[model samples]
Target: MVGLMSGILLAPSAATAQVSDGGTVRQLDQLSQCRAMTDDKERLACFDRASAAILASRAAGDLMVLDRKAVIARKQSRFGLAVPTSEMFGGGRADEVTDVRQLDSTIKTASAAKAYGRWNLELANGSVWQTVDALTFGPSKGDAITLKEAPLGGYRATIAGGRSILVKRIR
Candidate 1:
């Protein structure tokens, strides 16, 4: 791993271009400087120094790295909430889609809200949602539910093949 990194770092023009373009992180900029060293020992020392800096930054909580799966799991767990799509997808443009528009889970529990006939639903995944539409039907415990994105950036929930109703996440 170190040998491959050193080879890539030794490409001075490319490394310089990446740094100047502001595409490379600060740690990479440090490692790229190692390419300027002519002696192998000096270059290795520079790489070590760069690695130590990266570790220090991470230890200080200035840097965090997450894989796609972990991020997607977080997005799924946060579904039904009012989080903007741009924020959820790493601040990308509004048109980007990573397939996190809906959530399917069985009802873990259900109870009446303060409003007459309004229901508060707790899904198996631990998200809490409340019915916003008129209470014509109430979801029962263990009922399969699909919470989908409705028109105008709202949520519509359907329980066990019943009619869809407007809903919002309360927690």
Candidate 2:
């Protein structure tokens, strides 16, 4: 009992644990302890220390806290790929769509570019993106590609030569 109490006392001011929610998990026990303090100055100091500790933990990658703005931005960034994202928006809101993500890749095989129709692209990142729309220009090997959200919840990828194509992430 003494060891546990001592450990708690020595622990950082603001502590958080991983939860299913997308927001930061706050430790209530430490917060309650600070509230128990009768002195106003001591309570304030305790809260300040806790806040600092929480910030440190976040910086250390020990915790993840995302706001609504971040969620919306990520959703926009990932428009065509079917990546599951339930916790990014928290509670998997009914109105929020969690089945899209953007992908950055490079042309691995130059043979796929020869076809004027659907061209398969093997990205340097190992994910594959294919052009869903008709392909006019052929992309050379090692072409830099950027896949981003397009209007109407579609994804468009632009190649190094400023040639754009409607692509879908297959992998």
Candidate 3:
């Protein structure tokens, strides 16, 4: 009875170990693809797609897919965005909130201020930390901000006045 109980107790742990191993493999594969990519933008894009795919898979509740996606997301976040940790890629940690806020601010400021041209909006602690080129009432007079296709994929930012910016998560 003692031996049987021990085996049962350990079973779950063993399964978990296997899952972790599988996830690691998937991440490595994605990283390999990113490295093999020739263009800088292409590499970043590959990482983003792989990361997003992983997130979507996890949302579907497939453990195997979740594990693989998690790993790939971590790798892509690290290599593409210089994010030091996987938590930066939506790992549900404390810092994840900060990332989300930053992304939100980037979208929000671009939309609200009617800023045109390239603007890098940084956010921290639910507030805009700094705005580089915060205002550019450039030649374009339309409320819409056009985004060109970035190397990673379609990269566009547009601001509708007096409204929240809709930011589509890349990955």
Question: How high is the CA lDDT of each candidate model?
Answer: 0.72, 0.59, 0.36
Collision pairs in model 3: 111-159, 147-156
Q: In terms of TM-score, which candidate is stronger, 1 or 2? A: 1
Task: Kindly list the per-residue Cα lDDT of model 3 for residues 50-79, writing each as its tens digit.
Answer: 666555444544323223344443443333
Highest lDDT scorer = 1
Worst 10 residues of 2 by lDDT: 1-10
- In candidate 1, which residue pairs get closer than 3 Å at backbone N, Cα or C atoms, i.e. clash? none
Candidate 2 overall lDDT versus native: 0.59
Off by over 4 Å in 2: 1-79, 84-103, 110-116
TM-score of each: 0.64, 0.48, 0.22
What TM-score does candidate 3 reach? 0.22
lDDT by residue (1-171, candidate 2, tens digit) is 112321111123333343325432454335557879999999999877766765676576654454445555565454445664544343434224433445566778644544467788776756677787776666788988888778876678888858667877676
Q: Would you give me the overall lDDT of model 1?
A: 0.72
Q: In model 3, how large is the Cα lDDT of residue 14? A: 32
User: Against the true structure, whose TM-score is highest?
Assistant: 1
lDDT of 2 at 150: 80
